[model samples]
Target: MVIADLFKKTEITVKNIELGEVETLNELTPEQLQLIEKGLQTVGFELLDDKRKQIVQKIKTIIIEIVQNQSKILQKINPSVYIAESIGRDYKYLTTLFSEVEGTTIEQFFIHQKIEKVKELLVYDEYTLSQIADMMYYSSVQHLSMQFKKITGLTPSHFKELKANKRISINQL
Candidate 1:
């Protein structure tokens, strides 16, 4: 059987591959699959064993969906209940699994994601810091600035001045 077939039989789904370009897991060569698996291993987080890796991927998918749909809204709308129901597991179970595997809570992961989004907005230079803060659900501009500084080691204004490449590809994080 093909390497991709092995992955499929193991219920592993590759993420972010383009549509119409080898849609099924069964299309990859053994070497390609090995390389992909190695890359995941090198990511330096213990929560990436086969089962936890799937759970992490699922959480990432849900976060991305929520961000895309609610980009304009500031407050945290409790994650849609549909997400937990759709995942076929209790939210508490998934969250505990995530924290145990990732060494951080899911809320912290979400905050990191939001901070990354804030960096993207700062790079764009289209929105004021207040606007960015509001968009990302920060309670106030100061709150956003504090969290941004904590994460990035620079104030938002300093980041704006640098105008450096601020984008962190999701997988790289």
Candidate 2:
């Protein structure tokens, strides 16, 4: 992986890579971190050393993974618990820091990602609205519809009918 290569190139011992994060065996010096950051920036990656930014990015990554990859089992796990476990931090701390850095609450960011996922499903036309509701962990089609309309400024059916669903990327959200 690019990140692993960056670490290896810098002689940083990598202990683990999980949940879209890398754990190093030892603390990196400021110079080493700057070198890695510059290297990553050149390659369209980032090294967020600011604590708040790191937490915010972690929150977004968790939400993106849930929305894009694990939509069917979303309701089984609480967002707060899932993020806390994934980021290895308290949920309140994560929430506060994320809101401060992102200018939106984690829940709002999550909803946006879910809406994007719904748009993708609609564009696919592989599932009915009811099926999408079930898969997306909505209590009912109406709830999903309402949320979808609130976020997209159009009803789900209307959006689907438009034949031009404008889905945003998780990174853009």
Candidate 3:
């Protein structure tokens, strides 16, 4: 709630909190916006006033939530459709804009995030490879292993054996 607190401190009422949005009850003055933006910067958060950037962030947030939190929902829906439906935008525009801004396809970013999750599950040592694959929505353990190797340059088994802190932060993904 750092962002909400920042806005509250500036006497701005946060009406909603979505991944890339913080809706306010009223318009913020230039000075109030500046103060809130500065506060956000101090905490390594940015005020994405640009509409295009906000859309990109929303796309990232949806993918992250699906991969990292809503595994069951992810298994039930296609990400492209989900993103389009969630943001009320065409998937083609979203994909093109995301590629232009982030230098990677949305699909690639999703794969990276999934592999990162796999790495985390591997490190946890609480699940078998098969179970991890199932949890991650892989068709089979072999499929999971193939994709994991392709993305990480190491097999899941090897990654676990190394026991190195190889997981990437979701923000960096």
Worst 10 residues of 1 by lDDT: 16-25
Model 2 / residue 101 / CA error / Å: 1.0
Of the two candidates 2 and 3, the one with more favorable lDDT, higher being better, is 3
The true-versus-predicted C-alpha distance at residue 79 of model 3, in Å, is 1.4
Per-model tally of clashing residue pairs: 0, 0, 0
lDDT of each: 0.68, 0.85, 0.89
Q: Each candidate's TM vs. the true structure? A: 0.61, 0.81, 0.88
Could you tell me the TM-score of candidate 3? 0.88
lDDT of 2 at 24: 87
Residue by residue across 21-80, what tens digits does model 2's lDDT show?
788888889898898889889889887767777778778877898888845446677888
Q: How accurate is candidate 1 locally (lDDT)?
A: 0.68
Q: Could you give candidate 3's per-residue lDDT for residues 41-74 as a string of tens digits?
A: 9999888898988899999998998988836776
> In lDDT terms, how accurate is model 3?
0.89
Clashing pairs in 3: none
When sorted by lDDT, best at the front, the candidate numbers are: 3, 2, 1
Q: Ranking under TM-score, best-scoring first?
A: 3, 2, 1
Where in model 1 is the C-alpha error above 4 Å?
1-49, 68-76, 80-83, 164-173
Regions more than 4 Å wrong, model 2: 71-73, 85-89, 164-173
